[model samples]
Target: MLKEFQSLRLVETDFGNDVKTNPEVVANIYSSLLAKFDHNSDGVISLEEYMTETKKMMKDIANDIGFMPIQMVLEKDSLLMKAVELHHSASAAHTIDC
Candidate 1:
């Protein structure tokens, strides 16, 4: 991955700046990101594989970049709350039907 990063010329670019500026750090981050989306037990990531693993990939990336805590607080909580509410409503409807 470090080789890829160096070959891809991520030096001083927007991606390099936003993420780790150091080439080694960027390489590590890139490797981890690729592993996150590498489904089908393969080392490569295809579009279909990536789409299938979207949620897990995003969560893994967030966790890797130390954004998981903020994400859970800001997004996961709301999504889980909505899911719980929907489940409760569905349960109530089922009870009424019965």
Candidate 2:
């Protein structure tokens, strides 16, 4: 999760200040994302909701950091795909060991 966030250049700039490095700030960002993505006011976000919310948040962050929002969106997509790939590989390895 931290790696994904770090890949976002704008996030590193705007929120990258010392204050943003605090654990509390990181937790707040995750909590807010979860809350916003849970559209039905439900405690959980479906996969679709999570994707939609993530894109929106990325765009907002990009704009806030004075970068091209589209670039951020693309970067997010790349990061997500990488995460999925890693997860699948890890799961496959675990299954093989078992």
Candidate 3:
């Protein structure tokens, strides 16, 4: 699953196109990724570990990019888009006054 995730990440992030030719680079990246998720030193990441790490990473990102208008290329049916829709609905249902 880690290998699959790394392969997908490389493809998704437009890196390591030639995994066979550049095994060193791929291995280096994979090792770094493994080091990140193996936080408990158990050499494998469980679902709880993944979620905890992901949430921390997201929180760190939000803190670093605080109050900045974020523009992401999102699909219409994506979770983020759904969050936006929900926010808009709630806004429409309420009236804010100064």
Best by lDDT: 3
List ranges where model 2 is wrong by over 4 Å.
1-33, 67-98
TM-score of 1: 0.37
**What is the lDDT of every predicted structure here?**
0.60, 0.59, 0.64
Ranking by lDDT: 3, 1, 2
Worst lDDT 10-window in candidate 3: 11-20
In candidate 2, what are the lDDT values of residues 55-83, reduced to their tens digit?
76654554444433443234545745455
Of 1 and 3, the candidate ahead on TM-score is 3
Deviation in Å, model 2, residue 51 alpha carbon? 0.8
TM-score each candidate.
0.37, 0.33, 0.53
Candidate 1 positional error at 57, Å: 6.1
Candidate 1 — which residues are off by over 4 angstroms?
A: 1-20, 56-98
Candidate 1, residue 40: the lDDT equals 58
Going through the candidates in the order shown, the clash numbers are 0, 0, 0
RMSD vs true structure, all candidates: 9.1, 14.9, 7.0
Summarize candidate 1's per-residue lDDT along 48-69 as a digit string, tens digits.
8766676454545544544234
Q: Candidate 3: where are CA atoms >4 Å away? A: 11-21, 67-98
